[model samples]
Target: MFKILIIEDDLKMREIILENIHRWGFDGLYVKDFNQVFNEFINYEPHLILLDINLPSYDGFYWCGKIREVSKVPIIFISSRNSNMDIVMAINMGGDDFVQKPFSLEVLMAKINALLRRTYDYMSTEANVIEHRNLILNLKDSTVSYNDKKVELTKNEFKILYVLMKDKGSIISRDSIMRSLWEDENFVDDNTLTVNINRLRKKLEDLDIENYIQTKKGQGYIII
Candidate 1:
């Protein structure tokens, strides 16, 4: 199943698009936090993206450029704005196509199918991988590896590592980590996050990476 990432901020519209996508036999993932769009995108490694123009903090055009920096994954801009300038800017910012709002689910599916065919047919399925200090985090496979050693990680472990390494030098607060893990505000206790971090740390230790994840007293965690 091809994975499609939806970046629309409107909850109702996002749900509508996701429901249609599932009915059409495609996997759909929605962005939970607008501020972490790029990080979520990298973690999901979707085959295509459905982005909107109006968003919180930063607009879709900004995110389109950010996604372009890392991957050539197909991006289709979906927004209510249909002005010529908006259309032209979308294309210039590395968007594969643009679909105005009030679009039919049928048409959206057709566009998605065409893009997937054109992009993936005979194209290399390159693993979505990120590296920091010689430790490779393969997002596609949910594994981490170092020289002559490899370790598989659970979903939580992979997500925690992704956030830490993606930022690398900066300290990520505990609240931020929990939000990344459970965006719905579900009750994931403080101990849960600590346990997950400890487990992840041990895995790194197994790969001969000692103190790879450091704790910032009274702040949070950092990987430098």
Candidate 2:
């Protein structure tokens, strides 16, 4: 089953969208905090995103751009704004489709299924695999299974791992980590990154991951 991520701030709309996801026969995620869009997006690893434009601090376009920076998962803009410019802007910012607000729940679910089918249905039955030592990261399925046992990772942990794995054996600076993981937040300090990294390290350790994600004395971390 395909997973959906809803980024809308409206409580009723979000619940409706989530409740109707089962109606579309799809399993997915609904975000808890507008401020933590990136966090939820990375952690859930949903195949598609349902985003709203008028958000709490930053708008949908901004969050869409942020998501595009790391992942190519599909994004659909769902908002009250029906202006041509808004629609055009949404597409330009990397949204796959636009669903104007006050939409029918049935139609919304249909659009979601259509998009998922088009993007993933016939593409490949295989999951994307990236490895370092014994650890395996499946990009397509957004899963990091260890030694054939699925090791669960939060969005932050996965994103951090993705960035690190992409630059394996290289020193990825703390600033860089902050930039990638903290893009969606209004303000993220070093403490937040530290906490996230620490938690990720614990998870990796539990998986018996083999790597040297070394903290280079105020420089950064390197998965060597």
Candidate 3:
């Protein structure tokens, strides 16, 4: 089932949209921490988003632009602000649709279904980048970016970072990481892996992102 993320701050409206989302057979996810809206969007990797214009900390437009930088996932703006400018800005900010407040649940569901169909029928839903903290690793270009500075990665560096970031908090053994590289046809032993790890760390350090990949002593590595 397609997952829909609800970014509304109003509890009552959020609950209503979430309930109707599930009722229509789509998986519904929601944000409780308004400050972590962008983080939640990365973590959930939802197929589509229902975002409210007014929110605490930052408004929907800010978050929408941030998300647009990483993925083209469909976003629908739901807000009480029905101004022509608000609607136009929503579209300009990468929102796929705009639904004013007090919208019909049936109409909203229809729009959601149509957008999902049109978006995914001929396209892949997998995100091309993985984000942790403020770091974004672009799988398409084998590049790691922090702040606005980007560093190109070698095939080995990209593979290693991809393995660790894909399972951010988990302790991946050296054997496991080496096996992942092996699967990609880049065979390497323990010493070679260590060199690659140090090189990757140095690149991250250049970006001022220190200690991003932590060594777990007896264990292999982890990104937390």
Candidate 4:
């Protein structure tokens, strides 16, 4: 079953859309925390997204750009705004399609099905990228890029970053990080882990990103 994430803020409209989506035989998911939309996107891994323009904190356009930094998942903008500029901006900002508000559910579902078929039919694989605070980590290449400048990471550095960034808001313990390195056959002791972390921090600082990783005394490390 393909999962569809609905990012609409209107209570009635969001519920209606979700009900219709389930009626059409697709798994429907909605965002409970608007501030954590990106995090929910990562957790849900939806096949497609239905996004609204006006939202609580940052608008849909900002979230769309953030998601585009990581994945090419199909996005369809749903809004009451019908100006040509709005539609143009939606597409320009990486949205696959647009649906004006007070639209027929049938039309919306039709567009959804068409986009799903067009996008997933020919695409074989998805890019493995993680983005936080405008910093992008490309897992395939073991490199980190910030503000257009890129830096290569050693195997240990890449693994450590990956583990932390994968769970960005949570603190990862020293022992847990060592186990991750051990699983990768890196054989890292406490001192070695500390050395790798310092090196990674230096590289991030070189990219003008200070305090990208934070140390929590008596606990562990976290990227926030």
- In model 2, where do residues sit more than 4 Å from their true spots? 126-224
Give the whole-model CA lDDT for all candidates, comma-separated: 0.89, 0.79, 0.88, 0.89
Off by over 4 Å in 3: 122-224
TM per prediction: 0.55, 0.55, 0.55, 0.54
Indicate the TM-score of model 2.
0.55
RMSD of 1: 13.3
lDDT of 1 by residue, 1-224 (tens): 58999999899999999998886557999998999999999899999999999999999999999999989999999999999999999999999999998998767877887788778852145448989899999977899999989999998898899889888999988867865565222445689999999999999999999999999988999999
TM-score result, candidate 3: 0.55
Error of 3 at 73 (Å): 0.2
Which has the higher lDDT value, candidate number 2 or candidate number 3? 3
Rate residue 104 of model 2 by lDDT.
82
Model 4 has a clash total of: 0
Clashes of 3: 0
